[model samples]
Target chain A: MEQNACCSRREHDLQRRVRAFAEERDWGQFHTPKNLAMALAGEVGELIAEFQWLTPEQSAEVMSDPEAGGRVRAEIGDVMIYLTRLADVLGIDLADAALSKLENSALRYPTDQVRGSAAKR
Target chain B: MEQNACCSRREHDLQRRVRAFAEERDWGQFHTPKNLAMALAGEVGELIAEFQWLTPEQSAEVMSDPEAGGRVRAEIGDVMIYLTRLADVLGIDLADAALSKLENSALRYPTDQVRGSAAKR
Candidate 1:
């Protein structure tokens, strides 16, 4: 019940969709965590490639450009799908993992100390 | 309203949390999409590093080992957080972006064509 507080219904649905999509194609054997992680890394690279040469202003407004926006959205989708699949395969709760990580970050970089600054704590 | 069907409540909450966290620290100026995308790339590298030397089987079972699992979970957290933040900054709906991407992939790599194999389409 406590876990449900953080985990979203659609997140689980997306995970199930990913699982079923792979299952229907008998792709489980190929979806080892290592493989998924590597796939994830490749997707991240592709995602970053979309913003490779853009200025900060351009990067911020990328989604407004039809071609680049489509590419970026597709990459985001690829990244999330792989990430969701990887976490599902590993029995990891993404919401819990992310929230706890944020908590740790908050502690590490207290607002009062880190305000207006980007520095390691 | 239609978007609500795919978007989960907690996903938005997490995005809000990410936004607020940065806002409190005045980190928005530094969170250009390019920077966030690169930061995401770095986090993916860290996630990949967690399984760098592990065999497929080892990678699958890595989460059962507390020490490695903790590190892996933390990396996942970092990756997801950066990803969520990046998507948020771009005004892209993560669920919509990812779901549509999956739909596109289904068309590109039909189950019958790519079943039980890892091949590009």
Candidate 2:
């Protein structure tokens, strides 16, 4: 699939804004791609913590509770921010990478072959 | 800043595509929000593993190596797919959530107050 021009522009705008935000506070010095990737892991850890110990049904309905929902949303945002920064620092186009990976996944796990099974083929 | 219309549409479209991908393989049963969040953590772990024990400079330049770069990109894609799926399961607007968090971060870490420092305010 072709990358949408508008999406590309918006992603660039978002990256610029994030870069500016860090630059404004001289945080760029601290934002090595390694640090950002680790930070991304930390944020994902927090996201996972939100769902920890919840029953599957409860987790699926987590957003129904305002407080838990807010925490989850905030963690999600943190994860995205760090991930975006890491991609930018590494000169990777995140959206393209994701789309390409999805395409590869589709090929690797064809529907008919993988249906109802979690085993790696 | 208001969420761009095109960005919102793109995010939703991506979410739908992810959802359909899982549904097609009868994988929805394994995709509870908790499972997705944990899977997200696992992917982030893989991303961090790529940079582990490298000097900061080497970690920063990880993508200079084609093989390492591909692994990093694939890990990033996995993280995003699981994150996108988690948000979808919980009915979260991920872009809105990230923008909101960024706005909050701006307020929490004012440029003038936080400049040249890594301290969280």
Candidate 3:
């Protein structure tokens, strides 16, 4: 619980800070869901580009290379920022959305049915 | 603060549930950080695929279409799951990582230099 509180405090602070930054700059007018989604996809592509030709073994060591690690982390940060902004703009509660989907997924991929299967449902 | 506590409590429970689900099924062996990252990218691709053919206007209305919206939300949930797991495996705190990057981005793209530029820094 203590750990969770700490996580929440940091997350909550980041959320507040992000919102304030955008608001102060009057950027919300440009943060339509579509633009945010496209920005997210572009960032995801950039992250994948870093691993495009690497063998699985090489890819696995991505974080060991400080330069690649920094790039990967920055891309991940971009992805999260857009995602959070999109969800906020849409009035979606991310935690609730995730929890609900997880419940559905838990049912969809029951251990008895999905064990040892790589098939996506 | 209360609202944040709620998000934390739910997020904490969901994290526990996800870990237990994997442990009970003995799927941890396949969940190497590289594999999780790959899976996250794939899911992000799927999410983007939904918006690929749409114009900006259509993409903005994506959520109005129940079918597309459901798929998009599910993909988002998948992305979050993989991200949470990967961060856990890497022993990185998502909130902390995001905050540090946000700080850096604020410095790199300060309003005075980059406002309304739409240029990647």
**lDDT digits (tens) for residues B1-121 of candidate 3:** 4544323555666666767777766677777666777787887777678778887778778788998888878777777777666665655556556667778878887887766666776
The whole-model C-alpha lDDT of candidate 3 against the native structure comes to 0.70
Task: Tell how far residue B96 is off in model 3, in angstroms.
Answer: 1.5
Q: What DockQ does every candidate get?
A: 0.83, 0.70, 0.37
TM-score of chain A of each: 0.93, 0.90, 0.86
lDDT of 2 at B92: 74
Off by over 4 Å in 3: A1-10, A52-68, B1-8
Each model's C-alpha lDDT? 0.89, 0.83, 0.70
Off by over 4 Å in 2: A1-6, B1-9
For every candidate, what is the interface RMSD in angstroms?
Answer: 0.9, 1.4, 2.8
- The best-first sequence of candidates by TM-score reads 1, 2, 3
Expressed as tens digits, the lDDT of each residue in B2-114 for candidate 2 is 75453555566677788999999999999998888888888888889988888789988888899988898898888778878887787776666777888999999988888
The candidate, 2 or 3, that scores higher on DockQ is 2
- Find the 10 residues in a row with the least total lDDT in model 2 chain B: B1-10
lDDT of 1 by residue, B1-121 (tens): 5455535777877888989999999999999999999999999999999888999999999989999999999999999999999988988888778789888888888888888888776
